[model samples]
Target: MRRDPEPLLNIKANAEAPADARPPGERDPYLTHLGERIRSLRATRGMSRKDLARGAGVSERYLANLETGTGNASVLLLRQVAGALDVPLPVVLAEVDGHADPAGQEGQGGHRAAEFSQLVQWLAQLPAGDLARVREAARHALSPSESRDARRRRIALIGLRGAGKSTLGRALAAAEDIPFIELNAAIEQEAGASLSEIHSLYGQAAYRRYEMRALERVLREHDTMVLATPGSLVSEPATFNLLLSRCYTVWVRTSPEEHMARVVAQGDMRPMEGNREAMTDLRRILQARTPLYSRADVSIDTSGQDADSSLRALRAQLPHAD
Candidate 1:
């Protein structure tokens, strides 16, 4: 009943070699070689398969298959695995290339070519607006002095309900000696209605329109302020991109457990009503929105950390703060 162990070979180098130059049976050395490199790197770092798998947000069995050269991982999966392993994907690819040819030049070219392909694939997935905003942000971050004449500093704080945006925004504002603005409060005051009433009477689309109006007003009125935004803003791409273009966004990240506890402490068990799957749903939502959250300029893990500690971490990451 024993299954055969997976074959280990250098598949990457063989693929790069000219058809006439490749040895017999050396079909695909790149993939196998890459897998071996990953395994070796993980081992060298004293990380177990399970540890690497967990860090990569994949199953241990998947990591096992990959390490044994049986799994053909996608570029995205490879990137995640590389991030978890604390090695750039190109470095891993280069290592594979090195194993293929002792001289190393041939493999280096292949690695660079593969990395360029991966970058193109990633850029293609982003929305046009998001991509443009990212480029602008990168340019500003790289050369602040050049951007200073037209660069208006804006900070948008985003997180799930009860993730402490309001509390931390106030602390951050105090620390920076800047104004703290609750965007929802501004919306409510402008509309002469509460958020729940607006959502209940007008629906989500209408509420978003109102939110956009409020955001526009804020942008025009305040040059620099810490703005707390709703978590569901991700669902509105246009509005989200507008905010991103105009501000340096920070995701006040919290664990599902911490979010649940905070909501419960506030006596709002509405999220848990009649549904045994509430906790599961919350976790799924958080996981799904992580990519959007990661687009923020900075992410601070506020779970189990006090407001002051969170504020300090935020301050440390910001470009210029008191």
Candidate 2:
């Protein structure tokens, strides 16, 4: 159900459209609520997507899109899905009245395979009015000072390496007169070596340690700055969640072909020299991370777009980009 290329995709005329057409975070209220209830109940049962799909007599992809607020399930289908979760149909229907958030509205666009975290499960359990109250309390808590400009707090650009996060982030920062931070560079500085050397000498575990420490300092030192983040950042769930919680994130996306070309143009010839399945591997990464990346506050598709074009799209998404 993922857009595959854009930040969000419109429902299509094809068979896959029902699940993919509606953006994950934006779906019909009743349907969205029902989907969350289904998802949450399914999680508590420790059932995998395949298991539930088989039991419900539905395709795995349909179940996935349904859980993400993307698929449109019929009353009969809901009954099947409810049965699969071993919950009564009436219970599922009534719980749909709960009106909990489907996902982050701020993160409008898009990774994960279709799994709900414990946090999502807890959030879904709140009553209708309690959801709003909790959000209000969170707003007050997160923005401790009333006068602080939320727009100017922090804007992080996340995407595949060739998705133009670096290029667009630098331009946006220049236009906004804010600092531009490259997280990878900071990590290298902290480790006293290049990223390759750090990975080769100390391994990924050490590199992640340096990454988290560098990320903390940047968030602390700069109140307002545009940053280009590593695509692999989503692999570190804790840090990725922390990044989403603290900053207004944007997923900058482009086609896999474009990503490979851009990376090659930037002098990284490993894709061309090393792996024959480079494009396939890149596509797999994009697909696997879509759920995690969907946590971003917004998105901008840089595919076939020039610097000025992409910048304009980004600026429209974030006012501070100006």
- Stretches of candidate 2 off by over 4 Å are 1-152, 269-273, 319-322
Candidate 1 accuracy as TM-score: 0.54
lDDT of 1 by residue, 191-236 (tens): 7899868755765557778888988899889888889987777546
Q: How many backbone clashes does candidate 1 have?
A: 6
Q: In candidate 1, which residue pairs clash? A: 10-29, 11-28, 11-29, 11-30, 12-29, 12-30
- List RMSD in Å for every model shown: 14.9, 15.5
Per-prediction TM-score, please? Answer: 0.54, 0.55
What value of lDDT does candidate 2 attain over all alpha carbons? 0.71
lDDT of each: 0.69, 0.71
Q: For candidate 2, write residues 1-322 as lDDT tens digits.
A: 7644632222232223333234545676656776777765543332345656866779999998888766554543555566677655555554222332466432212122112233455667789789867855665466424222553468899987799999999999999899999999989888899987875577556777998888888888888899889877876755676677667789999998999899889987432346576676566667767766776788899989999999999999984423
Cα deviation at 291, candidate 1, in Å, is 1.0
Q: Find the number of clashing residue pairs for candidate 2.
A: 12
